[model samples]
Target: MNSLIEDVSPIAVDVYRSRRERVLAQLRAQGGGLAVLSTAPEVMRNRDTDYPFRHDSYFYYLTGFSEPEATLVLNASARDGEPASILFCREKNVERETWEGFRYGPEAAAEAFGFDAAFAIGALDDHMPRLLADQPALFYALGTSAELDAKVRGWIDAVRAQSRSGVRAPTRAQHLLPIIDEMRMVKDAHEIAIMRRAASISAEAHRGAMHACRPGMREYELEAELLYTFRRHGAQAPAYGSIVATGANACVLHYPAGNATMRDGDLVLIDAACELDGYASDITRTFPASGRFTPAQRELYDIVLAAQSAAIDATRAGVSFDALHQAALEVLSQGLLDTGILDKAKFGGVENVIAERAYARFYMHRTGHWLGMDVHDAGEYREADGPRDEQGARPWRTLVAGNVLTIEPGLYVRAAEDVPERYWNTGIRIEDDALVTPGGCELLTREVPVAADEIEALMRESISH
Candidate 1:
């Protein structure tokens, strides 16, 4: 059988090789250190059953090795003729393979993954001391895992014990995340391609849910539609828990228990997306369960839609992430004032409402967040004094080409004396995956209808057929 036929899609072997080379170059720049990374350990979902295992983001970013109990080591400055990239993974066991699944073992793992060498995980303890010796620095996910931390300390102690000889252990230890996280923030061509497909698949799932929705159906039924669409289109799983919220449940941000019965005249907010390969696509669409929105529901939905539109327009290169949030907030605040949700007499004006954050009563969350491999993904919002502001704090990082983020602007109106009674229990959020481009940004999750008319039309068409 051809090896290429069995390898994972979206990430080619050359992509993994280039990622390791990039990290190695950075490590060499930091004085030729030896860097170590480990995959996430398997965890139990219940008494005996194990939850599905996912590889660590940082580790997979470089090695593209998905197996658990694996570690990668990069010797940036290797001795002449020695390979710089090494992998330590589980040794193949015939019985275990029969019980659990296939094992690549070391030899095939190294060749398939483009590693310089590979060893059984059992040899990690024996190899660590030698790998740490005579290096200028040792780099790993410092303070992340106590077990890994203790293992590093043991290796260092072993190297120190050989002080009588000329051998030397690394004196400095650095955190490997900061260096690698910056690399993960920017999506490459391959990553963007995978994300685009993920986004398209997720968008179709949302459309499916919209078409399948009915007033008498349970929220979980809509969630089932999403899951079915996701799996049918080759998605691994939901990027996060599917949020199938109707009526008051939509007001709760992170509403995971989707068991409520959807009612007529209730607006359902479906905040769900799928994970394709290792990338994530996040999308949220709120529409009427009864195929037509009430007058109050349309009023609030249009406001939230306008805010999202403003935010999406502001999502361009060179603008700070905070700027997009502010743009969305401004639109939302003005909409509140226009719709009589906020009294200008008591809340002052639109500017005063935003300045005082009076809009928090209706619009609470930030406009968006970085979206990629891990959903929330890796990347810094701020850096050390890179750019200063009037308040003497570092400003949010500016958007750059290749940065993919979510533009989510939401509004939730709970019953209050100041709030209109008709708008009570109305919650709506419009979110889409956006990629920064040279001109502006591309909307990755735009296939689904967001406009009230379009959503109702789509639902009507589905019902008619």
Candidate 2:
């Protein structure tokens, strides 16, 4: 392995090679074909500046190639009786290298990334036609990119042009997302190790935010604490934009403008996590800015904490994905009725409230989402069960070992005429990443305090020290 590549990525070379071999085996089972994958294109942030470049998930899954302007080609059925993994990448240019940084040209990329054959990206148009000829099928992310779609069409046309000269273009075209998505859904040992590290780093960052938060401070100030912790621990970036919502702002699910000043009596809700080695960890913690929750705030916070506990308990193998959501909903519905938030006479009862989904007014979003390479990671939530219903309800998939997901249960009480005045403007959510196991599940983000008293105590200790 090259020292440069080793220093950049913690993933071993054999791990990447093994991933390619597994994908090739799956392709062979599908009767063999040629699959093409490309990295994300660089985008302009402004007139002359460019946004940070991140490679496409699928391309990186197999090749681990991070450079822009690169494409991976996998030929499962090769004419030479050996499978071929080819890479097309930027060639070395002294002038470009002077301005930019070093590029692993064709030779270095092939050796470093475990590709059998390598070519300059400039030759893709000339080489793709020959590569496409005589293949039984063509596999690519159909409809993903207009440029790539046109390039594939042009390559097919080039192959068809040679039809009379004893060449044949692929008659079958298939979408490669489902095949790769399934492979990525189950985390291998290596992926789990990296994810554990990511979770640990993010957990400490959340703790830091809780400790650093103070009344009269801006939300972005707390956000800065989180960013510092992530980068200080070697995380690449936040999995998503950090949400630092205080008081009423927490009522908004995806609030990005975290500029409001926190009040002494307000509760701050932070939904933030970081990405390490391309694996993501998502965690959310809601705590009082004054280091102690008031009576009404503690009431709502305890309810949300209980609901999250129920959902986490249900995250186990053989359970359907919706089961966890249903468990959390039941707990939240009962809690709302127990409190004055939901009127028993108007909503009829806890059972009727759940049936009518009346709880959505206060807890609108789903309990949680799949977390992985992307925050809402790939794997489909629905599985084929007979004919689909008219309401378009797909059957939920059963959880399996190695599946990592978040259990987040929240309650947002905005100012409403019918809502209890005491509970208004109080939003609380407790989220933690859980890995399903045969026995039950393991909470990856458990190091951060979730209990109300524990959170208060931790904050107080930080201040006194």
Candidate 3:
């Protein structure tokens, strides 16, 4: 019979192998330990309808297995000499596949995903204790997947009960996050490749939106064009919700309504997103609904563009993640002062008195976030002391080669009686996915038009053609 699961891409397969080796090395460094990991379970949004199933980000990072209810166990012991990773996945069920979809059972999972050992899901309870029998430390996220957490607790408890027969269970059960997150921070070649592709698709999607958007069109209609570009170009789906904001609707951050009418002279802030092969790309761009910016709109747009450029420049090896945010804030804060939105005399010391607070009213969100399997990707950035310490911090320690992230800086001004009349109903955001490298940072979405002139030319080209 023909297999429904398309052959896993080489890039995805390589990612799985690299992550496994990393976990093994970490376990070996720990002087021998075992870690149990599981993908998130399918969640129900309503009867017979399931919220899109996304594998646990961590699990997906390590195994590249998108299937739900799967478990991965790393068995490492000083006594055994080396560590091995075993994957447990759904067994062949023809009837179930006929109903829901096809699944790669253990044998197929082993061959396709490059696991050292493979077992059926039904064997987890029977096999887990045996794997953990004498491990001295357990590595796993304790409270994440409740059902899997309970199952893991039961398995550990059983192993603990056998403490009498010289079979000592893990004396310490540390959270798996830090160990795994360290590996995820510096993406390997394969991950970078996938992210580059994701960014390309995302950039194309944003360009599509910019070209299709018109003054009288509904925001959702613009969103539809973006999605069409995503699927047509082989993106799995949006990395996050598509934010299509027009007019005053742009003032509402996290606005997903996307149903408002885009009026002439308004800037359409499309935070269009896309993902490919599980690697994520988040991009945002503001376009003039009339195909050309007004004097006031151009002023704010150039400020944001400059801020975004400064922020991207700040992404480099050894530069603190906070540095980029601060750089962006400096640009935005001063822009506000220059535009008369902020009174320099009254707020003269605001930027100095408060770090990042002076611009918080207008720029509410963080300058950027880690981009990976999830959009607001996981991995802790700050240390326990709230400082950047690579040794102690997993993800946000420092920008390193191979790490992919977004630098998005935005300004939103809602309509108000006292507010500057010209600034009302204006929202501007510019975002780009960057890859930190040894020499400098590479802008992944550079192919997409960003400069005001470039964007206008692209829009004009589309209209003329």
lDDT of 3: 0.82
54-84, model 3: which lDDT tens digit per residue? Answer: 7888888888888887998887663454338
TM-score of each: 0.97, 0.97, 0.92
Q: Which stretches of candidate 3 lie over 4 Å from their true place?
A: 1-6, 9-14, 78-83, 163-166, 349-356, 383-396
lDDT of each: 0.90, 0.89, 0.82
Better of 1 and 2 by lDDT: 1
Cα RMSD (angstroms) for every candidate in the order listed: 1.5, 1.6, 3.1
Error of 2 at 455 (Å): 0.4
lDDT string, candidate 2, 1-465, tens digits: 546755544356678888888888888999999999998999999999999888888888888788999998899887675538999999988899899888898988877777898999999899889889999999999999899899999999999999999999999999988888988888888888888999999999999998898999999999999989999999999999999999999999898746899999999999999999788999999999999999999998999999998998888999989999999999999989988799988887778989898999999988878878889999898885755667878778889999988999999999999888999898888999988898788999999999999999999998897
In model 2, state the lDDT of residue 41: 96
Query: Which one wins on lDDT?
Result: 1
After TM-score superposition, what is the CA distance of residue 352 in candidate 1 from its true location, in Å? Answer: 0.7
